[model samples]
Target: MGKKDLLSTEPYKGVRDFYPEDQAFLNYLIATFRGALERWGYVEYNASILEPSEIYKAKGSENEEVVREQTYTFVDRGEREVTLRPEMTPTVARMVAGRRRELGFPLRWYSIPNCFRYERPQRGRLREFWQLNVDIFGSSSLAADAEIIAVSHAIMMALGAKQSDFIIKLGSRMYLDTLMQNLNFDEVQGKKLLILLDRSSKMPAGDFERELGEMGVSLEMLSPKTPPQDVLDVMERLKMMGIENAVFDLGVVRGFDYYTGVVFEIFDTDPKNSRSIFGGGRYDNLLALFDDEKVPAVGAAAGDETLRNFLETRNLMPTYLPPTKVYVALTSESLVKEANKVAETLRQGGVAVSVDFGEKKLSDQIKTATKHKIPYLLVVGENELSSGTFVVRDLVSGEEKSLSRDGLLSFFLNL
Candidate 1:
C-alpha cells in the first residue's frame, strides 16, 4: 500500500526510522561516544526539549527566528510562546547560571541528546538529529580550549576515522578580528561580508562575486575570497602560535552571534562533499547578559546525522549487522517443553538463542531458523529426548552431533 493512503504517517522529512540493523549501529555509535566522553573525565547532564523564549532573547537573540526560522515552536495551552529546543548550549548556559553559586568552578560536562533544526535537507544535514555536546564552563584559559579540541578529535578517531578522513579547522575570533583590522574592515560591513563568506562554497562563484560587489569591494574577485592580503599571513600566525595542522581555514566565522573567543569546526577532508561535521566556540558573555558576572563557557556539538554521513562517505560506520546466534527447534510435540528449557539454558550462558513454539512443521522450523541466520539449530526430537540429549546441527558447517547438556554448554561457551 502507498504511504499517503494511511491515516497517519511520519511528517518530518529530514528525519529517519532506524530498525534492528540501524538501531544496532546507533547503539554502538552512542556507546563509543559515551566511552570516549567518560575517558576524557566528563560528566553527563540533560536539558529540556522546551525552553522559555526569554532565555534566548536576553542575549540579543530572537525566539521568533528560532520559532519562525529554525525551530518547531507553538503557543502552549497558556498561550506563552514555547519552542522545542533546536540546540542545547543556550539551555545549558541557563541551567549553569541559575545554579552558578552551587556548582563548582570549571564544570566539565557532556550530553547526548536529540536536537532539531529546520533547514534544507541534504546529505550530512538533517532537521531532527542526535548530537553529543561537550562543554567546559568557568574557565578562560587556552588549556580549556585545547582540552575541548582534544576531546572532539578523540571522538572522531574512536569512530574509525583517521587524521586524513577528518581535519579540525580552528579559527579564533581574536585572530579573525585582527585580520579584519589590518584590512580596515567595517565591523558592520565585515559582519555582512562574513555572512557572505559563509555561503561562498555553498553558492555559486558568480553569485558570491556579485554579493561582494554589492559589499563595496572595488576588487571584482578575491583570492580565496579575502582580497587585498595574502591568506597565508593570518594562517602563518596561527601556525607560529603552535596551532596544529588539524587547525586550518581563516574563512570560518560561525553563524552564531554569541561566540567571543577561540572557535573551531570539524570538517570532512573530502573537498567535494566538504561540510562542517560539527562546530562550537567560547561564549563567555552569554550568561553575563542575564547576571552581573561574565560566566565563561566553551563547548562543541556534532550531529550524528551529519556524523553518520561522514562515516558512510569514508566507510567508517561501526559494523553491527545483527543475526541470531542459535535456535532450538522442537522436532516433535513430545520434545517441545524440553526444547524451551534447552533454549533458556543457552540464553543463561550468554548465547542468543530462540526456541520454536509455532505450529510450523519441522522442515519449516529449520527454514525459519536459517532465514534468521541462527548459527546452530538444535533438534530435540523424540529419539534425542529419550536419550537425555539433543542433536546440535551447525548451520554453517552442516555438521551434526549428539551433545549432552554439559557438552552443549561447553561448546557454546567456547564460541
Candidate 2:
C-alpha cells in the first residue's frame, strides 16, 4: 500500500485511546467505584455488549430518539437485528427476569460497562464511554430509592468530594402524573408537557412559554410550585442519613420512559462545569417485559468521562503513580543478569519491580525510571554484588539508604 493510503493514527472521532496516564486515571475511578459499591454489599454483574434490538424497543425502555437515532443497530448474518447497547438497564432487567426463579430477592448488583451512543460530542457527552451502573432489585419501598441515592452520594464522597461540590436534585414521575391529573390533562398533553419540562432548563424563557402555550398549557397552570409531601419526606430522610445535599427539583424528568417513581440527577455545583454528572431512578416495571410479574428496581449510572471532568473541575483527580514500585538499574552490561535476579527476588517478596536493560547508560536508566514516577531506584554494581548490599534511592525524598536484601524486602513490605 502507498504511504499516503495508510490508516490514520487518530482514533475514531468521539472515542478515546487511553495512554498510560489516562488509563491510570480510568483505573483509579473504576477501583474507587468498585470499592464503594462492594462496601455496600453490591455484587458485580456483566453481559454481552450485543443484544437483540427488540430489548430497547420494549414498552417504556427509552425515548424514541435514542432507539431511532443514537443506537448502533444492524442486521447480522442470522437475519436478526442486533444493537450495541446504548445503556445497561434494559440488559440487566432481561438477565434478572431470565433467572428470577433461581435468584434471591433484593439483589444488589453493579457493573462498569462501556456504552455506545451516536450523539453530538460535547464537553460532558461522548459517543463512547464507561458507566458505573448500580441497581437494587425487588424492593418496592421508598427506602430503596433513598438507598440508591445514598450509594451515589457515597461514591462522590469517596472521591474526596465535599457536599458543597455537588447537589442531588430529586423528582418523581408519580408526582408529575398526580399534578397532571389534578390539572385534568390527558396522557397526550401530559407527555408533551414532560418533554417540555425536561428541556426547559436549556430553553429561553420566552421560547419555553411559547412551546407550553402551543401545547395548550398556560404558564400560570405550570408554574414552579412547592414540591409534593412525598418528595419532601424523602429529602428529610436523606438529610437524617447525612446526605444533606439533596433537594426537590420538579424539572428532573429523566429521559427514559421506564422510570415510574422517584428520579434524580447529581449535578456538579461548579459554574464552569455545571451539568448533571450522572442519574438513575425507580423503574419498578422494567423487568415486566421478560416476566409475568414485575420487579421493583431502583438504580443509577455515572459516566467515567463526566466524573473525570467533575474531578478536574474540583481539583480532586488522583495522582498517577507508576505501577512498578521499584526500578532496578544495572551499572554495567555484565550486571544485567544480577539486576534481573534482584528484581525477581523483590517480586517474590511481593514488591512491584522492573529491571532496566543494559543497553541504556545508568544515568539514562535512572532518568527513565524518574520519568515513569517509580518510587524507588536500586543500583546493582560490583561493590553491592560483592558486599551483598545495595543503595536504594527514594525518588520523591531524594534520600539514599544502604540495605541488604532482607532490609530491602522489609522496607517495601512495611510500606
Candidate 3:
C-alpha cells in the first residue's frame, strides 16, 4: 500500500473536547443545578437530539434565524429532512402535546441535553454545547412564571452566586403589543419593529435611533410605560418570594417568535462577563402548531458555555476531585493476585480503588497516584499478606498509618 494519510486530531470548530478535568467541572455544574431543580419538584426528562425539521420550521417554534440559518439541517438516505435540535422548548412542547390526555396537569420538567447550532463561534456562542432547560406547562397562573424565575434564581444561588452577582430583567409581549398599536404601525411594521428591537441592544444608540427614524417612529415613543398588569403581578410575586434583584426592562424581548406574554433574561453583573447569560418567556401558543388546543408555558435555558464563563469570571469554578479515592500500588509482580484481591475487598466495602498492576518502583507508583489525584495510596506486598495488615499513605497530607486490612476497609467506608 502507498503512504497513508493521517486524519486531523482537532474536533469540529466551535465544539469542545472535554478531558477529565474539564468533564469534572461540567459534572459539577450539572449536579449543582440539578440538585436545586429537584429540590423544587422539577423532574428530569430527555429527548433524542435528532428532530424533524418541520418542528423548528413552524412559525411558533423558534426564531427565523435559527430555522433558516443556524440549524444543522440535513437529509437522510430516505430523503426526509432532519435537524439536530438547537433548543429544547419545541421538543418538550411536542412531547406534552403527544400525551396531553394521559399526563397530569401543571408539569414541571427540566433537562440538560447537548444542542447544536450552526452559528459563528464567539465568547458566549458555540456550534455545540449542553443546556439546562426548565419549563412549567398546563398552568396559566402567573405563579408558574414566578416559580420558574424562582427556580432559576435558586440555581445561581446553589452554585454559590450572590444575588448581587446577577440581575433579572423582566418584560412582556403584551406590553410590546400595546406600544406597537399606539405607534399606528401596521402588521408588517410591527414585525419589523420587533426584530429591530430584539437587536437594538447590540447596536449603538445613534444607529438604533436612526433605524427607528427611517421607520418614521421616534425613540421617544418607545419610552417605557407602566408594565401590563400581568407583568406587574409577576414582579410582585417575585419580590414577595424574596427574589429582590428583578427589575422591569422592556428591552428584555427574547429572540424567540413564540413568546406570547411575559419574558425575562438574566444578566451577569461582573464586568468581565457583562452580558445576558440566558433567558426564557411565556409561549402560550406554541402547542397551537400541533392542534387548536392552547397550553400555556414559561421556561428558560442556561447554556454551559456561558455558565462556565460566569463561574470562571467570578472564581466560582468547583475544584476537581477524582472518583477513585485510593490507589493500591503493587510492590512486586508476585503480589498481583493479592493486589487485586485487596482492591476488590476495598471496593466491596464501598471505597473506590485503582490497582497498579505494572509493578513499577514504589516511588513511581506514588507518583502515579498523585498524578491521578487519588487521595490515599496503599502498598500491598508479601509482608502485608503475611501480617494481614496494610499501610495507607495520605497522598495529599503525606500522613501514613499502619492498619489491619479490616481497619483500612472500615476507615475508607466511613470516610
lDDT of every predicted structure (CA atoms)? 0.75, 0.88, 0.88
Clashes of each: 0, 0, 0
Residue-level error in angstroms, candidate 3, position 175 = 1.0
lDDT of 3 by residue, 1-415 (tens): 4346767789999999999999998899899878999999999999999998898888633365577799899999999999999999999999999998888889999999999999999998899999999999999999998888889999998988999999998888887888888888887788888888888878999999999999987876667466678778999999898999998877778877788888989989977775678698899998888867888899999999999999998889888889999998887977888899888988888889899986689899899999999999999988998999889899988999899987888888776
**Model 1 clashes, total count:** 0
Per-residue lDDT of model 1, residues 198-274, tens digit only = 77768887887788777665433233343213223333444444445454454566877788777778888887457
Q: Number of the top candidate by lDDT?
A: 2
Cα displacement (Å) at residue 62, model 1: 5.8
| Per-residue lDDT of candidate 2, residues 1-415 (tens digit) | 9999999999988899999999999999999999999999999999999999888887543355577789888999989998899999999999999999999989999999999999888898888999999999999988888889999999999999999999999988888887788878886788888989898888999999999888777776554576666677678779889998898877798987888888999999987776688799999888988999988999999999889899998999998888899999988888888888888888998999998887889999999999999999999999999999889999899999999976888898787
Q: Each model's TM-score, in the order given? A: 0.84, 0.93, 0.94
The 10-residue segment of model 3 with minimum total lDDT is: 59-68
- For model 1, which pairs clash? none
